[model samples]
Target: MSFQSLQLAPELDQALATLQFSVPTPIQQQSIPLVLEGHDLLATAQTGTGKTAAFMLPILHRLLKEPEHNGKVRALVLAPTRELAQQVAANSEAYAQYTGLKVACIYGGANISPQEKALKAGVDVVVATPGRLLDHLLKGTLKLDKVSHLVFDEADRMLDMGFIGEIKRIMRHLPEQRQTLLFSATLDEQVQKLAAQWLAKPQRVGVDPENSAAEKVEQLFYAVDDDRKRELMSHLIGKNNWQQVLIFTRTKNMADEYAKELNKDGLPTLAIHGDKSQGARDKALAQFKSGKTRVLVATDVAARGIDIVDLNYVINAQLPFVAEDYIHRIGRTGRAGKAGMALSLVSIDEQWLLEELEVLLDERLTPQWLQGYEPDLTKVPKDNRKNSAKARKQRDKKHILGKRDQRRRKK
Candidate 1:
């Protein structure tokens, strides 16, 4: 029930106390003992469920007992994105502070020189994105042969981001006898197959069911035309006096556009996406987190990336193409058993996205219309051009053709 009961080393216990972590989350409680006993683990837990500490604490405890490998990474944590990798590294540093364990983080966007220097100098643990880590491994600058502990944090997202090949290549450099842990929010087919092929006799631990959102998250949908979504969101923020908000758009351009328009509406806003340099993204995140910016517009690149523990509001200005991503977007809020609000601005064209979420969550979702923001029924909204029957047929044709092209490539 408590961190003390986990029987962690005095240093770890004291670190947890300094961080004010009194109780272990469910995933932590179930996975820590098994990890300490040296079992490979497959844990199904969402990001904000304190899953980071669940695996990191025990791994730190074990690593503290061994002498640091001068140039070899003794413990490795693989993340999907730069943001996520940095977050894990931050936590690892905080937890390992008293234990004298050093941590290094490597990802694609930042300069690789510093990462290479860190690896050359030495670190007890390395948290990295698969692509950047693969680069290090290929260059012979980093070796994981001595790694006793490995963690796949957000396995599903890594796979979804098309990093499976890179992950597999990275794994080739690791020894088979090491302890492996795979953590995913959902045990989908891809993640399941990865677990089957990887973890050896792993203990399966789950504190939440598949595709389930946090219980305390208050979800609501606003039915407005696509064209007026920005207006509605600005109005809501201004009327409700929302100081901090995270809004998700479907594309990088949309993110930039939304940020621009919202700023024009007198709301301080910034956009972060793949197009931005890592420094710019980091600055944007800093501003948003520091409450200097009122709204942060982001693409799905940040759905699992941002780790604001006390974030109170999440808005889906545009629905994600993948229905399940709805869960990840809303997950930015309502973390760690905290009460939060997740609002989606749904348009006529995105009804399919909403429906898919319903099927995923196994529940019905009703969209509410604000009086002044409602789409004028008599007048056709511009979204009709994309959602019309003819448009649907065209989209279907493209999808079919794309699949045929994929099959042709396989041939």
Candidate 2:
């Protein structure tokens, strides 16, 4: 359906037409109306499904209709990561371009002075990460009593990142009388509980099934030895002449090491992770988006907000420990109805992960053996005593005890 049919304001209509957005996505079509009617909403949607615009457009419309009361914050959107926060802020700005509405993006890894200045300038909307937003609240740089529309974009990711406490703290500052929207890719038990607590007679919208991958993406699995997986990646990239690829690694060190080794072999690769400064991460992403970098190796958290249109390939250098994350990784590609490829290199040790993913996906995933990198089927996966779950728990206990002792000595 046409966006104009949604009864949006003239300003929003102009913005959509200027951006060449004539038709509303399914999620947008279902969500925009409920939000405009002042109903709390619990929406189940995936990335690249136009979910941002689903909530942003209606909020912008509502903000335009209601006169600002003392120029206080009228809307607040909380994202899981700084990158996702930036993405949502960008989209909000573009949507509010014609309406003269101001948006402030607050997050960590940068100077807080600038964010403080923006809040002092009086913004109509604030998009932020949970931790940094709390910092602003504690510093009295931001207030939320006037917030009429509250959004928890990617609620599942925020919970996965362990922001439950921060979210609860931030909620204590908001007015109970407001419109709330909770969007999640997966409506797991935790997400449902959050909805039950926050929403009041909400409209439930599910655009896609849970744990479902994009329909346009072609999924391929290859069995390669753990050590030879990198070689196989290089071979496939060169043989397929892939122009730009986003590869996901399991850890920060692995991302850095993969980029290093790939660049040493003349592949223009870059790595992005939490360890890098904000400026460095932005630069790497800009380079990759501009086609200057051939490949970008990243951890799951680091790759949260990457939205590359027409991105053809995504390589999972290593399978993720959590099966649901595989959906998030591949969702980066095959966006906006474009065809994409998700290639997973599974080693003998990681072969078990495939079973978990298959079970969640409700489909049997077929794996093919690469000619030269075939693994020994008879060999049992090696177990490292140091990396065992029990060992990790022990280390965590000792670390906590050490910190407690240090604090006691200081006191």
lDDT, residue 41, candidate 1: 98
- The pairs that clash in candidate 2 are none
RMSD of each: 4.6, 6.8
| Local accuracy of candidate 1 as per-residue lDDT tens digits, 1-411 | 789988999999999999999989899999999999999999998769988999999999888776766657889999998999999999889999898778999889788899899888888899999988988888988888999999999887887788888988888899998999999887677788899998999999999887777778999998998889998999989999998899998899999999999999999999999999999999999999999998999998764579887899999998876655777888899888898999999887677656556555767688998999886666543444433343244344433111212222333
Report how far off residue 300 is in candidate 2 (Å).
0.5
Alpha-carbon error at 63 in model 2, in Å?
Answer: 0.7
Q: Model-by-model lDDT, in order?
A: 0.84, 0.87
Q: Give the least accurate 10-residue stretch of model 1, judged by summed lDDT.
A: 399-408
Q: Count the backbone clashes (under 3 Å) in each candidate.
A: 0, 0
Q: What's the lDDT for residue 42 in model 1?
A: 96
Residues 1-411, candidate 2: write the lDDT tens digits.
Answer: 899899999999999988999999889999999999999999988788999999999999999889897768999999999899999999889988999999999999999999999999899999999999999999999999999999999898888788999999999999999999999887776788899999899999978887688888999999888888788898899888998899999999999999998998778999999999999999999999999999999999999989988899999999987667788899999887789999999887875567656555766677899888888778778663333343234333432111212222333
**What would the TM-scores of all predictions be?**
0.92, 0.92
